[model samples]
Target: MTSSGTHTVDAVVVGAGHNGLVAANLLADAGWEVVVLEATGAPGGAVRSAEVTAPGYLSDLYSSFYPLGYASPVLRGLDLARYGLSWRHAPDVLAHLMPDGQAAVINRDPEVTAASLEAFAPGDGDRWLHAYADWQQVAEPMMTAITTPFPPVRGGLSLLRRLRTAGALRLARRLVVPVRKLGDELFDGAGGPTLLAGCALHTDLAPEEAGSGVYGWLLAMLGQQIGWPVPVGGAQQITDALVARLTARGGRISYHARVDRVLTARGRAMGARTVDGSLWRARRAVLADVPAPALYLDLVGAAVLPPRLVEDLAHFRWDGSTLKVDWALSAPVPWTNRAVATAGTVHLGADLDGLTGYAAALARSELPRDPFLLVGQMTTADPEHSPPGTESLWAYTHLPFRRDWRADEIAEHVTRMEQVLEDAAPGFRQLVVGRHVAGPADLERENPSLVGGALGGGTAAAYQQLFLRPIPGLGRADTPVDRLYLASASAHPGGGVHGAPGANAARAALARDRALTGAAYARLISTANRALYP
Candidate 1:
């Protein structure tokens, strides 16, 4: 229901992104009166899909694949398939193409993947299988630890119980190991090492950075298990399913309602005011599905935040800016190596040394001359993405955030990116019936939470991860202010389409409002906040 001046609800959620919708659904499921406010006319933040390139060719505006979405326990528990969500996958999950034309392909069947790896090195197939077997032992508990709230009591205990069996300590060390080192330790050939290094580049992490292996190993393992699926029609279907589920549960989302400020009283978040001058008063809580800086600095106002938090925000780092190009192709990408055509997602880079150089350039605040590309074969993954006999494709690469992405700059980057694609796929440019480019500025204009096009909310570097995320405290959703939760990718378990941050926020709010423990919970959280932020 639309309201004029003052609207009251049990909870007010800022942003209608996937995380916000997830938070709203969970709150509504508990019978709380919840309302979500979104700045854009559409609901999805980065998950939207449209025919940006050409008619009848749907392209995901931002994220495309679904390995994390498929493996996420929070998203899985929602049973979104009941609300019109269906997944489709290509025959092969991913193929990483090197400049030398050698490719490492991951197949759904482990034996097939192993065989492909074996072709690169004699004993690597068995080595891959051994690693997979080890992952199998701790997969459940480890995923739980990752997707659940911080401290992860249950998941942590479960890991402890399986310590000896799962090689828990060794696995923990591997989680922090650099992808470059991890690849060398695990495989003797370029194929295996290239595959791991390429997957690690999916994030802002460089191959040599600590904790890069965690992302690389996790994503590679997920591709093996789930095949990096996509929604049947487009990425929008995932958003539609979440919205369907949310509205069905009696939650309402107000579109074009941009929250300008969080209304507070006595240091507690009580509501939020939109740019339209409408006040949404929440009697229970307010959850913000925005980047940390946006919530703490712009919306809440720096004066209202603790001086320490305001100072800490100065040190907050964003992931690299992005440059994306979408193409509506009249025919499939004619990859030089036929094997590359089989996969839904492809990683284009030279090798480990090239990846390191690319990272070095970004660190120096210069765009890489040869950028590493993460490409998606939309039509290959799901035929509905485009007209029959044609393909909907997109590729994105990271750039240093310091660069100015003007129109001319965007054009130059697009040409460079296409050149990289053309090298892997001969005549790649000839098949383009239509083309669209989105640089960092365009992305930020579309979704403010994607500051500088940093998709992961913030850097996933070890210094800013886990308990230290978005500035240290208890890594839970509770913020310095009472009755407010950070329900975005900026929170714990940093980025991905998993919706764990939102789930964690909702769960914290629910626990704080519980009948018997309500007061105690609030007091405990407040006490922790004081100590951390003081």
Candidate 2:
């Protein structure tokens, strides 16, 4: 019999973000009773949308484009389209504007995309196609390797078998090549390298950073393969689809229920106790879809962790924050470069030099005088995002991490950003009918996971990726804490709307449950460690 304010479920998932909901859905499908708790009144976490500026204009409060969202196997497997989640692909994927009033665009057609590069350099058209062909040879197996748990026995071996000896070595070298170097090696023109550099800037990595090339290549290929698509009704449609599926499967979710502490007994997690003093017991596992720092330091407390692990947590670095501006425009942006008018996503900050400067300034903990902007023209992707003729647009720039953020300072930065846009599109400011600004503080206030608005969950630096993610260990979804798992953006395949972390975490938990009993338990635990992959 359960006591008042106490309930028992096979699993308790803390947080209702995409990953958390995915974990809950999988667990419930496996016949485990699952309950999810969210701190906010709504379920999506940062994947939310609202008419913050005006009644008819829909704005994605945080994340907008879904190149990864459209490609996520976990999401695709769930068949979200049947749940009313329709994606709107842009006319062209992305465009990197050049200083001379021209732009490099990424088209879905391989021939067309390469042709844009060919116009700039003599043989670049062929080179771009050749490079994409090389990527296609390894893309599927490589993506499988990335999305699966570390030491991906199946996926990794498959990739290796495909790459063989020479190809394997070349693949390794390519992973660590800087964006600038990759550009310099591939094409002689500014357009190709500049486009890659802009994608690299999507993360906190500088142009010169090793492994920055991977981000550029990954996004570029993904954009080319599946255009940067967004949900028709805004990002919230994604959350609604996941929730619709989860609840349909008998999983439960309680919003505004913050888990204050992980309940432990006999050195294993039992469940969690909420701030409202509700005790929810988990018969199977407790999966936390929050940041590593929040899980270890805040919820679990430092006393429970090994001193060395706790010390390592102290050194864990986060990526730069964001300063975002959303607008309900009276008319579409009038671009100096007419090519940019039709682009779904437009990048500003010119070329490699400008991007490098923006990155360097952030690294030095100083605000950039000329910040790089990632602009999402919502109406370009989905006309329903705004009223008929008017447009809905958003631009975001990265900022250094900070403990101090003032409103006045935020406004000043906003003004500077508008100025930057004005240079690219002379009448940009005049088109703004309604505007909403979310600096680091505003971002944190909306979603705690955004910790300084580091959107990728944490730094995506090479040292922080793969097995070293969140913290150094085997990159399984399982944590050192028994019966508990870290199944969020902080986990493997760090950040993005992909549900790999959740699926992987649930798989790890289920595998552990099926382990041998008594005498053979030790051996099963060893198998369970590597068997965490899907």
User: For every model in order, what is the number of clashing pairs?
Assistant: 0, 0
Q: Write candidate 1's Cα lDDT for 1-534 as tens digits.
A: 445699999999999889998899999999999999999888889998999999999999999998888888999999999999999999899998888888889999999889888988999999999888877878889899998888989888898788764567787899899999999999988888889989898888999999999999999988887789999888899899999999998899998899999999998999999998999999999999999999999999999889998999999999999988899999999998999998999999668899999999999988788888999999999999999999999999999874366788778878888899888888988999999998898898899888888899999999888888888778889998889999999999888898999999999999988989989999998888889877
Cα lDDT tens digits, model 2, 385-412, are 8988888999999999884788887898
Regions of candidate 1 where Cα sits further than 4 Å from its true position:
none
Q: CA lDDT of each candidate?
A: 0.90, 0.85
Error of 1 at 276 (Å): 1.4
Pick the lDDT winner: 1
Candidate 1 lDDT (Cα, 0 to 1):
0.90
lDDT of 1 at 351: 83
In angstroms, how far off is 492's CA in candidate 2? 1.1
Q: Each candidate's TM vs. the true structure?
A: 0.98, 0.96
